[model samples]
Target: MKRKLCVAPSFNCDDDMEELNVAALSSRKESVAPLTAERDGTLFRHSLSYPLALVLRLRVLQIVCGISTLVMGSVAFIEERQKFNMGLGIPAGGFSILAAAVSIHTSRGWSLVTGGASVGAGAAGVLWIASGCLLIALIVQSCRTILDPSGLDNGDGEAIEDYRPSPRDLIVIACVQIVLAASTLFSAVVCARIDCTA
Candidate 1:
């Protein structure tokens, strides 16, 4: 009598072994997990550079302009003898301080709205000859920055680079400054005439 060993087919054995291997692989993949946290951290670090630099520059510009306005407005208020001049100067100083604070708080970035308004108010508050001169200087410097043609980027062939003011904006600012200067001068003349009449 010949005894034969009962065994499953070789194909079934191979199939079972393949299924076990696949299950093991799936479990291993689940355990190994992806490095999403590390990848996201690196991505955030890389992306923050440009925006941070821009914010820093904007804050610096805002602070400088704001301080200038405050100082000029205060000087005018102190130096002017007339109540009207004092009134103008006080508001100018207050607006300057407010603009600076808003610029620092808001992340929308600096623009002519805040800086221009401060400068315009400060210019309007010009009561003394020294403040007038300073106002003129500030206007010229701001116009230069606004009109700088080289501010456009040539490297990447982009239409514009950084934040350069438009020609229209410069023209509007110039007009406002001119009007403020004229008004200030007129006020000075009127005051002088009143003194003469008195």
Candidate 2:
């Protein structure tokens, strides 16, 4: 989507002109304070551009981490299923995949709700917090699943060696899950705090 950025025009400004412009801008914001509640489009109100880039970078990282989580979990789950006699029940890998999908959807759909036109704050808050908690749980589950030097995992440390899945994939999943959880939670907090309605 094309964001309508508020850009200050460049002009050869004398000291007096700059002071007048600053005063005018402050007065303008004071007038619109009731409508915006002092909330700016960017997450950081102090600066116009710095945190915007940081926010975007963090969001992109969150998306990448989610995708990697899905791919690694799927690969490990498939390989482990073939190697073991597990039932049709969903495992941590399955939950990881599910959470990855949720993370992707929430992160992508986040921009849509910034205008407060698509969804309400209450509903969005619930979804964001839910997804954050889900990812945190996944991190815990992934951490529990570790393998020794024998190249054998006990299926997220739940069962014995015979039931465990891929050990190598677990490492990748754990690392990616950690990154995903952190990035996602931070992004959600920013979303809840910012008011893009301006």
Candidate 3:
């Protein structure tokens, strides 16, 4: 009788290894998906065109602030005029509105002129810094008024959403002002650092 020899086929080992490799690759991809998504989200939030985005945001907020300030100033003026009283409140508020308007116009004009290049970036950055400082002042002022409920007397100098001024409006405005001020500050920093040459 001839001796029987049993030889294991090499294909079985290859198939097992291929299966394991495929499974490992799949597992790796699945495991990395959430992390990849999280990283992408973070980059998307932080990697925005800092200066441009800041400018745009500031433009919109400035418009809103200008309009609000104008309204408030007008109301204050009418009330004061009716009472035969003259004060700096109206003028100061009006000046704030004017400053915001000028900032908006300056930014728009500069963007149009320089196309966000190095030509006027320095001047623009300075202007942005100034505007941001002004915004910070406004934010501080708003905070003082919002934090102290008693700070608003007759709600004359305060903003209101309804017939009677409510603290809710002030709180909301304060929150928005804080956000705007922070964004302005961040924008100023970014503008200051921008190379503008590339």
Candidate 4:
């Protein structure tokens, strides 16, 4: 009877060891899960300092510039009677806004995504460059019309009216527009080059 009791105790110890092994394995699995999630970029959020962090500070600057450009472009278009102002303002500003939003959304922890944000950024860069070119042309034309009204006159005695923005105002508007376009262009270049694997 004593031998039987000792043998039963030994069998119980084996069961205890097996349970401990299973518990250890489960604990290991639990620990590994979070690491995998973090590796997949789903577990943690990144700050603005990282080049491709989830919240890019540069995008905020871009949004501000975009809004200013949009407003300026609209005002110039209406006040200057320049169709090119609206053309430059609306699309370029809207594109900058849209691309920044997408970049903010698609960038993950310490990295950017594969397709959407990058492509949008590249397209935005091109649009900004285009806007800059258009602004340059508008400035040249306004300057020519202001400096030598007779050069563009067609014998109708069409005069540079008081309603048209003055040379100073035109220069201010064009300069602001060009600066915003250039800034947005720089931001786009930064965004487009963000590394996905980092």
Best by lDDT: 4
Candidate 2 Cα misplacement greater than 4 A, ranges: 1-54, 82-118, 147-164, 190-198
Higher-lDDT candidate of 1 and 4:
4
**Residue range 13-87, candidate 1, lDDT tens digits:** 788999999999998877666654345532323333224344445445434544545554454333332223222
Of candidate 4, the 10-residue stretch with the lowest lDDT total is: 109-118
Instruction: For each candidate in the order shown, give its overall lDDT on alpha carbons.
Output: 0.43, 0.50, 0.50, 0.61
Cα distance off (Å), candidate 1, residue 58: 2.6
Give the TM-scores of the predictions, in the order they appear. Answer: 0.29, 0.43, 0.37, 0.51
Among these predicted structures, which one has the highest TM-score?
A: 4
lDDT (Cα, 0-100) at 129 in candidate 4: 64
lDDT by residue for model 3 (59-162), tens: 55555554554454344334333321112223333444454445544553344444553344455445455555555566676567467533435557763333
| Alpha-carbon shift of residue 50 in model 4 (angstroms) | 5.1
Please list the Cα RMSD from the true structure of every candidate, rounded to 1 decimal place.
21.6, 15.5, 11.4, 12.4
For residues 1-198, what per-residue lDDT tens digits would candidate 4 score against the true structure?
455443444457788999999999999999999977766433244333445532377878888888887888787676566646433666667767776766565554323233333335465445556644654554454455445433324578675564445546655666677677777767666665653334
Segments of candidate 3 deviating more than 4 angstroms? 1-122, 153-164, 196-198
| Model 2 worst lDDT window (10 residues) | 84-93
Model 4 residue 95 CA deviation in Å: 1.3
Task: Quote the positional error of residue 133 for candidate 1 in Å.
Answer: 21
- List the pairs of residues colliding in candidate 3: none
Q: lDDT tens string, model 2, 104-176?
A: 3344234343432332445544545555656666666555544341235356755465655556765664566
